[model samples]
Target chain A: ENRNNVDSNFKNYLINLKNLLFIYLYQFLISLKIVFSSFIHRLIALCHPEKSIKNQIVLITGSGGYLGRHLALEFAKRNAILVLWDVNEDANRQTVEQLKSQGFFKIYPFKVDLTDQKAIKSTAERIRLTLGHVSVVLMVAAASFKAKSILDTNFEQDIEMHFKISYLSQLWLIQEFLQPMINKNWGHFLTVSSNSALIDMPLISSYASFKLAQTKLIETLREELIFNGIDGVKTTIAYPSILKG
Target chain B: ENRNNVDSNFKNYLINLKNLLFIYLYQFLISLKIVFSSFIHRLIALCHPEKSIKNQIVLITGSGGYLGRHLALEFAKRNAILVLWDVNEDANRQTVEQLKSQGFFKIYPFKVDLTDQKAIKSTAERIRLTLGHVSVVLMVAAASFKAKSILDTNFEQDIEMHFKISYLSQLWLIQEFLQPMINKNWGHFLTVSSNSALIDMPLISSYASFKLAQTKLIETLREELIFNGIDGVKTTIAYPSILKG
Candidate 1:
């Protein structure tokens, strides 16, 4: 009787193992299908140039910065109306001048610090009133990177400043601007993240941490938008490596 | 002459293609080797349980929380000294009492609001004076999760509070404690992150963003430690899914 019991138990175990193997294989195939379909969709999009930005209202934060200025010019070339925001008034004005010199007249420049929530809300309100509706927002604002050992950094000043600018500012701006996009159900949100988001490194803990936060925020926003059936609202996170200015 | 020019160009293209293929194959082999080695190392570690925590000084932040309290019990069983920090004094005391009841003696508890940098600094100083150098820092402190839509959230109060607690607190504690660990060259840093860091969803943008930042900070610190030749300083990031309280 004991031998019979052991034999039955062993047979049951083998059957359970077979069931588990089948379940895993089924799940693996499903995952592969999803990946393959997504890859094909991406390939198609890459081959077909979609000039969707033509005549769209494009808002660029940190428009005074190097990449931001060039992005502004590109949007202008694509015939998109440009709304440029920067903390530095003089530098922003210089960008405005440069755009005007290139015969891009539909450019508006605003000097606004993104870290202040109240300021962001007020400026966003003004932009909505002035420029019909913002169809695309390029979040390019970043605190200047500082190389400091974690020990050498001040908690409230250095670390908090980076968090406020890189992470919190993105939230505030998205909160202020996302409503109109949701209402329209057609908008593009692009965030410029750093390669540090993927590859961990030393000496820029504050910068890397905040950038990772920003990247994750964009991803969450994307998923939320899609899940809510707001598929027209697209999100892109660009992780660029170090740029030599 | 045109035919001859085309022929030479085609030959050059074929040679360049061969060189490109060689370069790609070399890089692919290198990457494969790295992946294989790391997989083997992980498999070995998984098979052999290393009791590294025995007799080590282990600090648990937010020790009143579900996971934190349990972790304390585990460390206590492992014969490690325990230092617990929490914003909730009553809950933290309860954890300590439970440990004591279980015959775990070397346990200390402190009430700390992690948002206040000054308070953190002072308390860390006190811990140093009392507990000696903390060998393993388990950064598990998290602001209580709140489900608020991005539109419904207050930028300054809700979002900023989460950022302060989740991100800045980690930075401050690491700053305060990292030097001693570096000096000893034998320490472990473990951060408790969330599944939200990988799979983004709605209603917890603030929490997810900060948690992602915290996760990235741990990773970067790990890399930095290794690069700086402090291999004794180990790091682990734990990403637990939803837990029933």
Candidate 2:
């Protein structure tokens, strides 16, 4: 009876392994097909006329930062009305000045802190009243960097700060902007998450948690949009590695 | 000039596709080898003598709850010293009673609120004084359930509660218990995250975000342990789907 049981257990294990391999193989083939189809689509799209973003209201958070300023300039060049938000007043002004120097007159810069929910809501309200509805939102604000081990981290100061800036800010932004986009059936939501969110990295564990939370929030939002049958509103997440500028 | 540019683009696209396929195929083979090797290792491990947890101090949070109570019973049967924590006093008492009825005398139950970090630290101090050092911790405490969409959710109440229960509690538990284990070069930390952490689901977006955070925190801890060369300490994350019973 003992030998029979052992033989049966081994047989069951082999069967399970085979099943797992088959499933993985099926998924692999499907992914390959998707890649090939998307590649072909991109090639075909290159021959087609590019979609215009002219006259669209584009809101870029963390506009004073390196990447944010470049994104603002690109959108401004496309004739998109730019609403630039940054907590740094001087840095924001610098971006505005740079845009003005480049002859881009449709730039609106706001020195709004992303950490405060009430402040974000009020700023969003003011923007809606003055600038019409924002059609594109680029959430790029990052809180102050505190590289420390999880054991050495302070909960209220370090973790909470990252939580508010990386995750809650995105939540509030989506709440304010997503509904309007859903109503119009056309808008874009883009958030910059780090590759740390995908991989396990030491020293930045607290920050990575919030970044992962941010990515999950965006993903959930996308799923909700699809479930509600709203296709025009799109969400994009970029997982960039360490940036050097 | 346009035709030449198009021809060059097509050639470049094909070359990129080939490179991508090669990279993916290489990864596929590596993963297959890993799976096969791990399967063989597991089979060999089955033949080896099982490691005993006898006399090891095992701490389980949320011991009053369904899964928690059963886990406590199992650990008690293994002759491991049991330290159970739960916010519900009556439920915790019931778990203790169940253990006593089974003639298992090594049981300690604490009515500790996981949301309060101070409370957790104090309770942990008391446990250490009373029960020596905990070598294994199962963070199973779950905060109150609030099923609502992100739009209808309150940040201070629902989201914060889940954050405290699902993620913050794990962090605090690790903070209190991990170092002792690390000093001894032996310990196990286990956290229960939901399958919702992996897949996007509507309605429970807030809960899902924190669950993902909990999983990420565990994963980051594992990586940190590896980096610090703490091989004896182990971390685990469970992603269970909706439970029927």
Which prediction has the highest lDDT against the true structure?
2
Q: State the displacement of the C-alpha of residue B56, model 2, in Å, after optimal TM-score superposition.
A: 1.1
What residue runs in model 1 are displaced by over 4 Å at the alpha carbon? A1-44, B1-42, B47-49
lDDT of 1 at B60: 95
Q: Cα-based RMSD of the predictions, in order?
A: 18.6, 13.9
Please give fnat for model 2. 0.54
Which residue ranges in model 2 land beyond 4 Å of their true spot?
Answer: A1-51, B1-50
Worst 10 residues of 2 chain A by lDDT: A19-28
CA lDDT for candidate 1: 0.81
For every candidate, how close is chain A to the native chain A in TM-score? 0.80, 0.80
Q: What lDDT does the true structure give each of the candidates? A: 0.81, 0.83
Q: Model 1 over residues A45-162: C-alpha lDDT tens digits?
A: 8998775788788999999988899999999999999999999989889889999999999998998988787888898899888778899999998888778766676756577677
